[model samples]
Target: MENQVTQLLKAMVKPDYTACSYAFMQDGKIVCADAIGVIDKINNQPITTDCTFNVCSISKIYCTVCVMQLVDEGLIQLEDKVA
Candidate 1:
């Protein structure tokens, strides 16, 4: 079942988004958790579980705050390329 979940994540990559992380639960417990695809096309870094993603509208605030903090620090610029 874990292998199937992993394969699905791999198959779902590209064409739309380059990478995704997934967790499948069974009976209120996590049965499978993993990530697939390169972090970006340029660096080709593998997406790790430690990385955070704003996957839905409910997550926008957290991502927005992180981005805004980066902007304030000038670590990320308006001209920066985002993946």
Candidate 2:
């Protein structure tokens, strides 16, 4: 499975794609983690699993989870406006 994933990632990076970092977890423990390609095209710095990316949509999921947790704790109501 890991080899297949690595091969797939290698195939992906061959085109216009810049880089990728992925991790699979089971029971809160990471089963596999992989990173590929350069961090910057100019300098050709390699990226690692620890490197941060500006993942835009993922923040929405995190915000939703936080709001749901607040609702569960009776700290906020669903009808409340967030501003």
Candidate 3:
């Protein structure tokens, strides 16, 4: 799973300024985690798990989709409080 994640991230990497990181959790634990590309072009530094991204509005899209999926599956209600 870790190898697959690394390969996927490598394929997703683009341009000189872009990097991709992915982490998959199962049974309340991370099963695969990876970082690819460089965050700093000047120093040729590699991206790490510690790196923070200014995701802008991208997270909103993901959250909305996930919530809607749960709603459609009857797993959650829109008015339900997140406990």
Candidate 4:
């Protein structure tokens, strides 16, 4: 299963699609966080695990964490919204 996912990622790369990152989650734990491709064209090289990538949509994870904390404290109803 993991190998197939990796192969699929490698197959998806393109000149324009220079970088990619993925995280595997299990039981709410991040088991794998990896990336591939180049950071800068001037120093063209594949991205490494240590490289920082902009986690754009992933900013919602913090929101989720905050919501979970609210739930834990019994401070929010399931349908509550911040306004």
Candidate 5:
């Protein structure tokens, strides 16, 4: 199952999707970590496991964590009006 996913990712490489990273975590630990693509466009480098990808959007779970943190700090009330 894991190898199939890895192979599929490798076969789907493109200039637009030049950088991609995948982490398979199970029971709170990463079981498999794989990355493919370019490290830098200027040098036309290939992306490797060590290369970092930028995550631009906040996921729903991340938003929930931020809300919980704000609640813990008493910065906002649950019933407070959102701006």
Candidate 6:
């Protein structure tokens, strides 16, 4: 499975791409973690699974889901101010 995933990533990597990282988890435990390509294209620094990424809009979706969960639990009101 990991070999297949790596092959897929290698195929997807383009000349313009710097790096890619992936993790697969089951039951809250990581089953596979891999990183490919360079962290700094200029310096040629390699990336690792431990590298941090700015996940942008995905964070907003996570926050919205968390707020919705709180509303479902009657811990927060939808009309309430976030601050």
> What lDDT would each prediction earn against the true structure?
0.81, 0.88, 0.86, 0.78, 0.80, 0.92
Tens digits of lDDT, candidate 2, 1-83: 77788789988896366799899999999999889898888888888989989989999999999999999999999999868
lDDT score, candidate 3, position 10: 82
Runs in model 1 lying further than 4 Å from the true structure: 25-30, 56-83
Please provide, for model 4 over 39-69, each residue's C-alpha lDDT reduced to its tens digit, 9 standing for 90 to 100.
7766898787677867787889988898889
Q: Model 3 misses residue 46 by how many Å?
A: 0.8
Please identify which of the two predictions, 2 or 4, would achieve the higher TM-score against the true structure: 2
Candidate that scores best on TM-score: 6
Runs of candidate 5 exceeding 4 Å displacement = 58-83
Per-residue lDDT over 1-83 for candidate 3, one digit per residue giving the tens place of the 0 to 100 score: 78977987787787754688888899999887879999888888889977999988999999999999999999999999988
Better of 2 and 5 by lDDT: 2
Q: Count of backbone clashes for each model? A: 0, 0, 0, 0, 1, 0
Which tens-of-lDDT digit does each residue in 1-83 have in candidate 5?
66877788889977777777788899999888887778788898877777765665657778889998999999987888888
The best candidate by lDDT is 6
Score every model by TM-score: 0.54, 0.67, 0.69, 0.58, 0.61, 0.72
lDDT of 4: 0.78
Instruction: Rank by lDDT, highest first.
Output: 6, 2, 3, 1, 5, 4
Model with the higher TM-score, candidate 1 or 4: 4
Residue-level lDDT of model 1, residues 1-83, one tens digit each, is: 87898887777787458788888788999877888887776887788877787668857888889999999998998778989
